[model samples]
Target: MLKSLPMLLLAILITSIVGIIIISIYQIYVSTVKQNKFNVIKDASITVIDRCGSILPYWLPLLEGLQNFGQQILPDYPFSLMSLYKKTLMPFVIVYVTNPAWAFIIFFILYYLFVRPKSPIPNRPFIRFNVLQSILLFLINSLLGATFRALPIEFRTSLYGLMVCNTLFWFVLLTIIYSVIKSIQGKYAKIPVISQAVRIQIDNQS
Candidate 1:
């Protein structure tokens, strides 16, 4: 019990911090939406569906990347997200792993379709915002993955490495889920530094 006390406390602290952040973000979002009521769309269903689709292109590649990262490092578990993923989504993963170029192709396609400014194509603010967020996530994942690969081989297979990889997976999963939920509610997902950067990029494009 004594040995676990610190871990328990750490878990509690993390939970509290996450709760506070979520509530604060929601409050700020509500206020912002109120101030920009005219800009906010009342018809959320259509927009929600479209916005949700924005992340799908990024999601598969991220999934494939995680699985590849864990190839030799992670041990076989009878029941885990990766295991379940393999059981159900192996086909998609295989395709992505085999042809990594598809992620880049999709990225370019999404940018041209939704993110490009002043072109002959139509632009959508909500979906465009989500797409940009997804793109940012993909880039961050790729960078971190490269950094992760730079670590010593022994350390890469160590418990700490597993923790790092797990953290990345959780971050990707939770962010997408949170973003999708906000999209479903016709609200923007404010992902701290990420959303701020996206906002600046959007402003520049405008």
Candidate 2:
């Protein structure tokens, strides 16, 4: 009873914290939308979405299609390996993408507290690589969203740039998803430029 009591309290505390964060975000989003401050919210929202949306290919069929693009270009195995992805991964990914602001805050807090020390888990190459990858991706997405915002609304809304953005989005998304899956399976994806940068950061930390 005593041990269970502490666990119950901890769970309640976590739930309360999460609820508060969500409420705060909801309020901010509502205020921004209501006050006609779309630009401010749009940049932040799209940046987070682009950063985390990379994980969607693992769960989304359209994204998975993009990842297995070669199958479409060539006669190949009619079955998609992505279908074999663990079903348990979807709920977590969906929640993260849907509430990216909250997800990022919660993940950053947990990572800093439990994974950022000289702990052996922190030293793990795969974990370090992914952390760096996520950070870089976030920065890239931020810049991209900001640049998009600078363009005229008509241009932004036009189908002219849609194809380019769509292609780039899926490319980055699938690449990250592939790396994540490989990491989970105890392998490295070894993406060229990104992998090199991740290695440098991990080495410097070590």
Candidate 3:
């Protein structure tokens, strides 16, 4: 454990930083690209679902279908409201609310059961990253709900902060995962934090 301290600390730091960047990018994407909300949501959702391995391919089509639906219906609605609704409603609201605790449960079970066992990439940096991220998100969301009873301004701000953090965290996590996988597969991987953590974890595990 002592020997692994650096990796653990690095993992936490990188995950938090990447998570924030992910949320920021999502905010920027939604704000700037007025027409790509559906596509952006679909892409982000698919990225998360892909982490579940082969059992989740079926949801890919469902996400795509929803994207198609959004593309069709969203144009008729006000852009700002529609973007806000999609961000708040579809990706985060409906999916998150319906599943509730499943993300954390699934993440842990899959990490120890499937990911650790199969040892797909031989380096499970993302496992730790994802674990921390999921926990943080759960806490943030819970806090946001409780804050709704306080001053309305504070509540709304808290809500936005949560969304921003959630979006960015997943974005960075997904990006890191993708880059790590590609690098393992002999592709050019460019995510510095993930790549570094993957190396450390792989070395430690070995």
Candidate 4:
């Protein structure tokens, strides 16, 4: 366990780093999109100003000033690719990966009903428990995320709250990946409650 401590810490650190990077990237991308929208509005106004110069002589300069003011005050908001990615694609992927609502249902039905204890596979027990623990972790993360989401948007969007939530998400994801690798190597991952539950179920089956 002492020798593995560093590996565990590294896994967690990697997870946290990934979360930070993704969040930072998301913020940067969104900001870029907003700026782009504002720029587009300003450019369109300038184009109108130029066209009005040829069509209207006396009002051209006044219209140009008003259009410039409007560009500053009422910039048109375009549909950003970042918004689409963050709101639609990211959520779908996150739900599929982190939420065990569907995974748990499918895995349990398949594992218990079809996978027998006396299977010839040498690593069957380890694989079974690994999957169980992974599912449990996913459920825990999903619930945690949901609970955070239930908070007021003001708090949920705060830096501190976002950091905490991201850290949890990253930690669970990295830990699950690490656990899977260990199981493939015929090692038992010592996840506290879930591991104990897996052990109990295994013994009862045996």
Candidate 5:
């Protein structure tokens, strides 16, 4: 019994040490970046208009994602808001994506009204960043859709196409959702690659 007790004590001691090390590492990570350190945090200093402005732009990508790949993800379930949205709102999104004139009108409005360097209506950095990010997302999804269309019909209809579409759908959906949530919380969504590009472009213009 004493021999077994020594082994048990050693096992517990090792476990305790390992646990402490893991907790220390976790604390370090949290201390360094766990509170979304890279993201811009909005507080009382930020206005309601700026926060609200940031949120609406994300819908462009959200709708674009839905228009392109929603059916595959959210099948027509009865009484689903998505189903309703697909029925009511998808046609307009389809027009926005397909008709350059309609899209251009929107782009003209947003570019002139919000993100442009010298706009009549004043804009906030948070609003401008979110709007630009949304525009970038829209452009990306458009390019991807066009590229897919250029591929041979066989490839477009193959398992590989499904995989690509699914991946893109998640990318657009998740990124926009994250951005929207952050905007709601008055923070910038610092998504890799995209956010950096948006920041660089905005900084250059500024």
Candidate 6:
């Protein structure tokens, strides 16, 4: 039991890191480049909220800070809205790879030291979702990165199809994951057609 505790903790940490990475990507992208369509922003926000919800009250403050920053900086930008959106989230990119683990550690400490003892919700779903999301993101990103690195430089130069498909697939997957997490929290999550897959997963798990 003692040995398993560390492993379990590590799993939770890794999962939180992946979720942070995904949110970092979305935040940076949206802040730098303005999306004309509301759907795009809504989808991205839902993903952010779903992942952020796990971390609880901390996320709310961080997001509020970001929003305040946006109000101050966005109006002064000269480029297209999309470019501005991307720039805002750029700071988190390095954290995704560098101290990714720190985000999870902080969250775990926060929960264990405070929330877990007071909150009525069971800890199992929260821990399970964090672990599941992190493992999935780690596998997907590592595979994609490895595949891209293994390909010849010349091959990558002409791989627009691969790039496009990968981006689309990632966005879709994020939406699905976010929706599933929301459902698990007993919320009504709507993510177009992808919510069906999340429902299927939840059903199977139960």
Number of the predicted model whose lDDT against the real structure is largest: 5
lDDT of 5 by residue, 9-40 (tens): 44335535543554456445645776568553
Candidate 6 lDDT (Cα, 0 to 1): 0.45
Write one digit per residue (lDDT tens) for candidate 1, span 77-171.
44585577666545455555666676677788878877888544556677788888888887887777888889897887788887777677667
* Candidate numbers sorted by lDDT from highest down: 5, 1, 2, 4, 6, 3
By the TM-score metric, which is better: model 1 or model 3? 1
lDDT of 4 at 109: 52
TM-score of each: 0.69, 0.47, 0.34, 0.45, 0.70, 0.38
Answer with 2 or 6, whichever has the higher lDDT. 2
Mark the regions of model 2 whose C-alpha exceeds 4 Å error after superposition. 1-100, 110-122
Model 5 off-target regions past 4 Å? 1-42, 71-100
Candidate 4, 93-206: lDDT as tens digits = 334344424344544553563245764444444445554564555456556656766778787557676566556644654565556444322356787777787678777877
TM-score preference between candidates 2 and 5, better one: 5
Worst 10 residues of 1 by lDDT: 43-52
User: Compared to the true structure, candidate 1 yields what TM-score?
Assistant: 0.69
- Residue pairs clashing in model 2 are none
Residue 110 of candidate 1: its Cα lDDT?
75
- Alpha-carbon runs more than 4 Å astray in model 6: 1-82, 98-122, 159-169, 180-206
Clashes of each: 0, 0, 3, 0, 0, 17
Question: Which digits, one per residue and each the tens of the lDDT, describe model 3 over residues 1-206?
Answer: 24434533444355455444554564566557843645533333323222322212112222222332333344446889677857643653244335535444544654564335355554434344343333333344345334433436553347575454345434433653554343222233444554455445445655
Comparing 2 and 4 on lDDT, the stronger one: 2
Off by over 4 Å in 3: 1-93, 117-188
In candidate 5, the residue pairs with backbone N, CA or C atoms under 3 Å apart (3 or more residues apart, or in different chains) clash, namely none
